[model samples]
Target: MALAQRLFRTKPTEQIVAEGGHGEGGELRRTMSLWQLTLFSVGATLGTGIFVILGQAVPKAGPAVVLAFVLAAITALFSALSYAELAGSIPVSGSSYSYAYATLGELVAWICGWCLMLEYAVSVAAVSVGWGEYLNSFLEGLFGWSLPAAITHSPGQDGGVVNVTAILIVLLATWLLLRGASESATANAVFVLIKIAVLVFFCVVAFTAFRAGHFSPFAPMGVAGVTAAASQVFFSYIGFDAASTAGEEAKNPKRDLPLAIILSLAIVTIVYVLVAVAAIGAMPWTDFDPERTEASLSYIVNLATGATWPGLIVSFGAVVAIASVVLTVIYGQTRILFAMSRDGLIPHIFQKVNPRHQVPVANTLIVAAFISVLAGLVPLGQLAEATSIGTLFAFAIVNIGVLVLRYRSPDLPRSFRTPLFPATPVLGTIFCVIVMAGLAGVTWLAFGLWMLAGLICYFLYGYSHSRLNTEVPR
Candidate 1:
């Protein structure tokens, strides 16, 4: 009983806040303003998915993919509300992991942090591969020359040797991260504007070719297809909570974190709905080819204008957009690891901060090295399912953490609260599980294997070395 209690030890909310909570660098500054935080959320959330997912989702839901985007948005909103409430109340660095530690226990927090590695790290690697493809496309258009297939494609792709451009982009983002958080957020805001402009332009052009006949068989694949597509579209909404990860750095974390979470979702949902509606109306749903849809936005533009310049412009925008995704996702990864390290759940090296930059330099480099290798050598076409499932798992935990906190600490001053109380979190958890159930069997097996590996590490290292066990009085 004693050992069990210790293993499931929950960190007191006050201690969590007071234990050098700015993370390892006690002077980690709060430089992000409300506008910058919102832009970061918008930028991180507006990743390669909007540019790539339409092809896959359109084929699944036909013209009703617009409805699928709405459905996915609704599903994500439930969790987003939970995130806002907790972020407002806790204002911690480790996104859901820190929330879980405060409301649940160490074991759960460790698991949540481990799953985030999948959501952020692997996702960055996958997005980096995409960045390489679009970069090659842009270069081929501008200079009539592109990197060789071996250097631009991942292994098992067109006999690829290594994705050198993918590795390069990851290294570039890593260099930016080593500079500091404020610089990265400013750069991300610029990227967000470029992405929004490109999407808005695509919508305007696509509407010129809109036809009502496209709606004749809107739900051609039925309700099942809509649900399936929504499940996948959910991936497009993955990085909205990224703003929550910036809790420690926000100038007004309690107010800005919640606003950023809600506002970012609202912005991305509007863009997704408009783009989906415009794309479906502009082209026959039957004509959306999955194999050729990787460059779907550019393809849509080319079809609308009957010219190549628009497609080239969209491709250039895509290269820029995906590069920003890689940047923000990798940034989120390092912070989560830094938090875990501060709790002594990982090596101390990750928690060390560079006094000059006020950033976890070691943590950033290690994560960058690992993600770059994956980007260069791995074929991540199928890894997206794993990423989706991992995110849903984290969402489910965050929802549960909210409910637990509300019951356990009713008087905790919250800058924001889930509007419907238990209903919001309950529905959020249920929807996340339902979406997760749509994934393939292989994905579950892989997730399980990953979790098992995490547990092994916890028992061997984290359990013994955890700050909660060693420092906090039992």
Candidate 2:
């Protein structure tokens, strides 16, 4: 095979476009506006991480946990800029995966898409599990009764068996996605409003209890701790870039893609910082216990304020918040797979859309099945770290892709461009690397194993079936 043929395994871009050819699938409906796209990103980005991750990270960074949130936001900003550039130029559905295929090569594209599967699919499962806990808390708060431990908690946590509630929630989201994209996005916007209101409510109540003494001895774990915690807390910011995935759907891809991404990131980052400040200041950072880290936001509010009503509201908000996260993440997962399948890198089933709904039903079902199994069986901590590693890896690739595309196809029409060019992407790469390095050895091992599996799949299936291998007629 020629070099280009080996790399892309399909017709070159010039030939493909000359023949008026795109991937196998039909175009997605371009119904989303900048505001909806921004909310989609926010809906995906804000969830369990802020409600649950703080307790785990605070012990590591002490008062410096606030600094960790800031660092993570800064790091996310770098990648968001890079994504804005590529997304504007490509204006495709697969986000970084599509951008990589167009610029990096087919093989690299497959790897990026595969890693994104981890970012979206596994993260949905992890978020669903968190949702289950909040739902149980909400139910108990309302009725003084909850599901059995075996059906509520994942296996190996508190000696539970399966997470039935989590699995059910995933299944429910799957059904909703199969209905249609417009329906899902509309419902997500509503959920986003409710979730935000709950967070604002918590901040108000928690801030009322704020004590300056709690912030004393700031940076108790020092700068090292701040960096470590920032790395872990970085996962909370993953969804902010999700707006880029809707590149093709944005009203004006070049203009709105970047705007949606940056606006969503800024909004979510502010919300997270405010919530963290309120939660920690309301109660001494030292008082946060790891064991109760999984409690509903309401529980945290109740503990801090000694009021059952605040906890009740918080629990209600968490139930809705986590459900929205699962729905949005799963939507993202199916769409990316749909893009891949249309490219002939995955089975055709992934690209098949239901005529009635115009959604990738098969892809949604497959993602939901995997996520349900994961939510039902896996531990939250292990699943969370793995998801983080996958997302960071994909973010790094998007940053690098921006630089590569700038050199390889500089004249290509781009609606938006990264402000600093090489410097911005370079900084983005470094920031992702630093965060990746902070992950535990076990997380790295899991990532390695996942990559190895991807390699095997590529050689066996993707390489042979890639659409790039097909020649376009003169």
Candidate 3:
């Protein structure tokens, strides 16, 4: 193939389907049902961002932070529709990477995969970095004893050598995943239910202190602030498409994956808006400090009830819930790499599944090791924005992918069709661009550097060995 042809060569849909269970190590075990897939996505999306980012977002948008969440959800809804349609049509473990390959071409597919690497790894690491403070909060609240601050916090957050608690949470989640996806999904389902209940409990408590006047002059900073906060909070919706990464492992991916994608987004949107409404109604947005966002809900509960125990319960719930985020996002990162590896874009080590457990054992461990370092040692506060930008970029690609595939293969069997056809997808792409515009200059710089590195890696490695270019042993 000429260089240009190699760069833009598309993967055939029939071949993508045929290669479903014929990867390098072995096929992913198909065990996930509709609800399990839904919970996987729920566990990923209803994550540390809402639990923490609310304090940060609220300060920017004031009481209209409620609107910020709604706006972010609206943006996500457009992408979710595209995801639902494409995931159902081209169900595969690669998620948007595979979609882009079958639609856009080899180069865009590699970039999409690279963007996913940044989105999943950095976001999960950021969440794990915050997991420590909550773990200590839960511990101190329950037993009146906490891990030494030296071990419990990342540097700059506290005078700590390492965030042992952060690494510990990642390790625990990794072990669960190593056992198998079924076990991991079961545990994540439990985590999702508990966190949902805790969030509801917080709403109940906060409403007790609700003041009608707290919402006056709702958009205190007006449209600009709300849009900026919407951009920031949009990161909260990053993992709604996580179920698509498990397509090879889903029992009926065509029907269930799209349902899980849409259903999980709906569930997350409702919970986030309810919590934001309760929060703003209970306390003035002026009191929200962006710096102290880790326990915003628990703090609200304590402030409302003037009782520490309820807040402590809230803290414990956040602890488990945040751990659930770590588990699911790490699973997402590993699976994305697994798909890339099978396509000869990365080392085959990532695709090597353990025979006994039917999981990518090495892939999980490698991803966990990098995440542990990033969470335990790095000051990741600024880098969180990078995830939002990366996610938005991938979302734009998927929206575009839907359009390309529809025109190229009109007869493709689609279990779910995006409402409004071209309008939905075009708007999805436009909305993603709008949100990406809200991100900071530093975030754009980070994204640019990241994408530059991805291109370098692709030219050096992925371009030379892609299965689309040269025959890759299956």
Counted clashes in each candidate structure: 0, 4, 0
Task: Please state every model's RMSD to the true fold in angstroms.
Answer: 1.6, 2.7, 2.1
* Candidate 2 lDDT tens digits, 1-474: 675557753223443223221234454566788888889899999887777888789899987788899999998999999998877776767887877777777888888898998888877877777666678788888899988888888898875799999999887788777777778888889999998998999999988888888888998888889988988888888898788777655667668888888999999988988888888878888888877876635566787778798888878877888888888888888778877887778898887766666677767888888888889997757646677788888889889888887887778777788887689999999999888887889888888888899989988998778766754522
* Window of ten residues with lowest summed lDDT in model 3: 465-474
TM per prediction: 0.96, 0.92, 0.95
Off by over 4 Å in 3: 155-157, 471-474
> Compared to the true structure, candidate 2 yields what TM-score?
0.92
Q: Which candidate has the top score in lDDT?
A: 3
Estimate every model's Cα lDDT from 0 to 1.
0.87, 0.80, 0.88
lDDT of 1 by residue, 1-474 (tens): 377786778888777666534555545667899888888888788987888899999999998899999999999999999999989988878899999999889999999999999889888888888776788888887889987888888888986899999999999889988889999998888888888999999999999999999988879999989988998888888888998878777899999999999999999999999999999988998888888866888988889999988888888789888878888888889888888888999999888888888888888999999998999997766565588788888999999999999999999899999998889999999999998887889888888888899899999999999988886465
For model 2, what is the C-alpha lDDT against the true structure? 0.80
Per-residue error at 246 for model 3, in Å?
0.5
Worst 10 residues of 2 by lDDT: 15-24
Show the colliding residue pairs in model 2: 9-468, 9-469, 10-468, 10-469
Model 1: clashing residue pairs?
none
Q: Tell me how far the alpha carbon of residue 334 in candidate 3 is from the true structure, in angstroms, after superposition.
A: 1.2
